[model samples]
Target chain A: MRDSLVAAAFELFLERGYEQTTVDDIVRTAGVGRRSFFRYFPSKEDVVFPDHEQSLADMTEFLAASADSDDPLVRVCEATRLVMRMYAANPTFSVQRYRLTREVTGLRTYELSVVWRYEKTLGDYLRTRYADRRDGTLRANVVAAAVVAAHNHTLRHWLRSGGEGDPLAEVDRALGFVRETLSPDAVPAGGGTAGEQEAEDVVVVITKRSTPMWRVVREVEASLGED
Target chain B: MRDSLVAAAFELFLERGYEQTTVDDIVRTAGVGRRSFFRYFPSKEDVVFPDHEQSLADMTEFLAASADSDDPLVRVCEATRLVMRMYAANPTFSVQRYRLTREVTGLRTYELSVVWRYEKTLGDYLRTRYADRRDGTLRANVVAAAVVAAHNHTLRHWLRSGGEGDPLAEVDRALGFVRETLSPDAVPAGGGTAGEQEAEDVVVVITKRSTPMWRVVREVEASLGED
Candidate 1:
């Protein structure tokens, strides 16, 4: 019945436009009463996105099942794959829905709320993992947002291309920024980490701009001597 | 007249509740007709966030004025301050609205759209700035989201605390993470970059993880010998 209702709703959304299609129109087209429609979906907007509730639960559980030893950043990155899988499960439906959402303002806002829920879930899990750190809450939130942003950008790129190719691979590359640049031992993109490194044995020498190479070598030797 | 409608709407929202309050009631309270209310705000949601349209324009203009040489990451971080300044401008009102949005699901979604717009603005500005790079669009969007996430986390902390203290200082500290960890020259936090020097000689040694300090020094000395 839920599937029928979603199908009926999408049919009407695609045919008559999302704004033009009413709940009564959807229920009537599905050959079900309005009460049955309400039983399945609280609002018309809810029908356009039937997979989020289950997907969110699945994502939350997946993160919960992760070990403490796993890198929280990587775990969160992996979790985004679950979302891609949900969309990939039915590329036809997902592509149609994506197109509908791009054209409909209400659906777009609804989509943002759904994405926010996923980000919040990731944030919550990371917060627990990084509880000991002083900026645990901040890092968790920022990383969660970054993961979602990357995931969405790549997912949208795929969707915009009519859902061709592997979204998972694209998403992995996108999420790598969160891991590579933001990781504790990150060697920043352009090399100099504006100023700090956490691990031992690695050395970053900071000098005034345009410093001579010979002087740079001297500085490295002097630092080595001190060590 | 616009100010009066906003004042009247917030007044009724606090007293009679947001859901229960209607457009008719707001117009009645403001001593104006419904048409006048719509003239100022397209919807009740617009009244709750009366400042965004103008604040966004100001932020866009600020970014538009940036020079080619300005660091784009830092520019985006600075752009977020305009948003913080908007919320900090009216602490009492901002705090009240924040409370109301937290309680109302509709308002929360509405707020999310508003936030999405700000993030989009930052992203658009960044996209133009980083257009020459291959991953420009991806970096632009991710950094924009990161800046907004950090800003909101700190802003909400202030709002949750009844909007007390210097939000600017708090936001600057929060935004520093984006600059420090994500910046091209950023030194990761902890030890290596902690001792930033103004010496004329600088070197960066990237080696295998867990490499011994002796090898790192030797490696540095070898590089100098080649030079």
Candidate 2:
């Protein structure tokens, strides 16, 4: 009945504008009673998207299954992918919902509110992971934000591109950038050496014993003068 | 008028619960007309906020002033500090606002929405600074989230502690963790020199010799095998 009501709402929403559609119109088209519509959705705007409560529950379950693992970062990536898959699973409905949401300000804010809820969940998970360290709280915030950003960046691109390409690939690429930035210390082979850290005066020399200290000192002095 | 309304709302909210307070009740207490209340605020929920619009505009001006400088990261730090100072300037109101927001679900969501707006502004500023890089978007997202997280962490701590300490120092400490995490390529002088990278391996060898050849490799490999 809920699914039928959602389908009817979207159909009416498309045939007429969202503003032109009402709860009575939705029930009339769905062949369901007014009580049924109210039972399924708190408001007309809610039928346009998936059940966020269910998705969040699924995410919580997924996280709970892997709570013993020390890798919070990897688990977050997987959790985000789980959400992407949910959207991808029903592409036609997702696309229709996205288009409808764009046309409604109230719906857009509602959508954003849902996204914020997801971010908070991720943030909470991360905060728990980093609870023991002095900088755990800060690290959790960055990691949570980065994970959500990567997901959203890919999701927006996918939506903007008419949902034509492989969204998971783009999500992976965005996540890769995040992983590298946060974990630059794990920089792999052949990616060139890591950049310098400019905290204090530090000199690095790549030379053999045949090179004299006086020449090195002269070079250092010259570099300092240039600076 | 807005100020008086806020004071009245807080007073009523404390005396009665948030759920018990209505716009009509607030206006009656403030001795303002309904038109006056509507002119100043969109809803009763908006009364407890410190001028978010004004703070957003101030942040915009702060970012605009740093357009020619190279240190955008530092500029954002100061902009965030401006927000913290505003909260600190009114400890009683902030503490009361916190208590009310915590108790009211609608107010809590509204507060999250406002914080998300702040994050958006910070992210947009960072994207401009990191525009030329491959990971600029991802970097901006992480950095922005980190700033908000750091600020929120300190803000919550202060609010919980009755706003008694120097939160500016907390912000700095949080920013330092963020900056270091985002760019982790620190090198120490006169310490162990870096070694060649491998896909599954990274070697940091401490040696007195200046030569780079089989002897060094043998020493490193022999010691590494022991581990």
The prediction achieving the highest lDDT against the true structure is: 1
Q: Provide the overall lDDT of each model, using Cα atoms, as 2-decimal numbers.
A: 0.81, 0.70
TM-score of predicted chain A against the true chain A, for each candidate: 0.81, 0.78
What total of clashing residue pairs does each candidate reach? 10, 0
Query: Which pairs of residues collide in candidate 1?
Result: A193-B185, A193-B186, A193-B187, A194-B185, A194-B186, A194-B187, A195-B187, A195-B193, A196-B187, A196-B193
Q: Give all candidate RMSDs, comma-separated.
A: 5.8, 9.7
Worst 10 residues of 1 chain A by lDDT: A187-196
Residues B1-227 of candidate 1 have per-residue lDDT tens digits of: 89999899999999989999999999999999999999889998899999999999999999999999998988989999989998998999999999999999989999999899999999999999889876889888888888999999999899999988999998998887666657543333222422222212334454433445566556555544443
Query: Candidate 2, B100: how far from true, in Å?
Result: 1.3
Clashing pairs in 2: none
Full-model lDDT, candidate 2: 0.70
DockQ of 2: 0.19
Q: Model 2: runs farther than 4 Å from truth?
A: A67-70, A184-227, B184-227
What is the per-residue lDDT of model 1 for residues A1-227, given as tens digits with 9 covering 90 to 100?
A: 99999999999999999999999999899999999999989999999999999999999999999998888888999899899988888989999999999999889999999999999999999999989876779888888888899999999999999999988888888887556556643433233423333335545554334445566556555554454
Q: What is the interface RMSD of candidate 1, in Å?
A: 6.8
